[model samples]
Target: MSNYEKYLETQLQDLDFKEEYDNLEAEYQIIKAIIDARLELNLTQQELSAKTGIKQSNLSRIENGNCSPTVHTLSKIARGLDKQLVIKFV
Candidate 1:
């Protein structure tokens, strides 16, 4: 591995760093999935906001996973994107 990568791996060996990294990675995955779905529908955040009647800023927050969207809000967003939201319980 490259020096930088090795350094990161070494740092991630710490419990706190590993937990934080895992959380961030999970958030990144969710955001990426949302962005990918939006791209698949060729809809920008503004377009999604217009269709769902949700504010663009709120959509931004949702994409960032900084804001938790209600079930109704998520349904609206999925409908705006011509998709459906599925939740699986483990």
Candidate 2:
């Protein structure tokens, strides 16, 4: 793992940090999934926004965790990227 990844793992050992991390895990995964998909297809936020008709600013907010994306918004983004958005319960 990278130094930053190792650092994060070490920091997460703290009880308080672990608690907060667990709480935000789902949201973090969602953001990471969207970003990973976009990067996998070599699309920029502006390009994806144009294709999805979602404002670039909103896309930025979603990626940065400044705002939550609704299912409808996620669907549009997925469709624009020719992918499916799957919600799993585990």
Candidate 3:
């Protein structure tokens, strides 16, 4: 494995670190989904901002994991991407 991957693997061996990492999994998934969907549609943050009426800065923050987006914001983003937002607990 690469140095960073090896380091991360070692770090994850700690119960505390693993717990924290697992807790953030959902947030990471949300960020990945937004980024992937935007790329799939070939949409820039600015373009998405126009479509969703949300600020490009806010979108950037969300994508960067600097802030948590509300369900309303996520719904807006989904519509802007011509998608439907679905949340599930499993």
Candidate 4:
């Protein structure tokens, strides 16, 4: 590789970004999955709230992955969206 490319790579490696990267990556995945499921049902936040009996703000937070949803809340959302919530360990 070129010197510039190597230097950039070295800088990236020198930065301890694993924790930040992992957190952001997991949050991205969670939000993406929720958004995808909601989109599949053609439901807006308001509509989802209406169906799930959850407040729009709470739904928004959950969809954004800014809040960790409880199992009961997730189950309600999944039932409202006609989806299933599954938790797994990697």
Return the clash pairs for model 3, or none: none
Clashes of each: 0, 0, 0, 0
lDDT ranking, high to low: 3, 2, 1, 4
Worst lDDT run of 10 residues, candidate 4, spans 2-11
**Angstrom error at residue 69, model 2:** 0.7
Worst 10 residues of 3 by lDDT: 1-10
Task: Provide TM-scores for the models.
Answer: 0.67, 0.80, 0.78, 0.69
C-alpha-based local distance difference test score of model 2: 0.87
lDDT of 1 by residue, 1-90 (tens): 544357657978899988887878755555666777887788999998999999999999988678767778878888898888886655
RMSD of each: 6.0, 2.8, 4.4, 8.5
Tens-digit lDDT track for model 4 on 1-90?
A: 544336435645644654564557666566667777888778999999999999999998887567988889988988888988887879
Deviating ranges (above 4 Å) for candidate 2: 1-17
Error of 1 at 8 (Å): 14
Name the TM-score of candidate 4: 0.69
Compared with the true structure, all predictions reach lDDT values of 0.79, 0.87, 0.90, 0.76
Model 4 C-alpha RMSD vs. true structure (Å) is 8.5
In candidate 4, residue 9 scores what lDDT?
57
Question: In candidate 1, which residue pairs clash?
Answer: none
Candidate 4: segments with Cα more than 4 A from true spot? 1-19
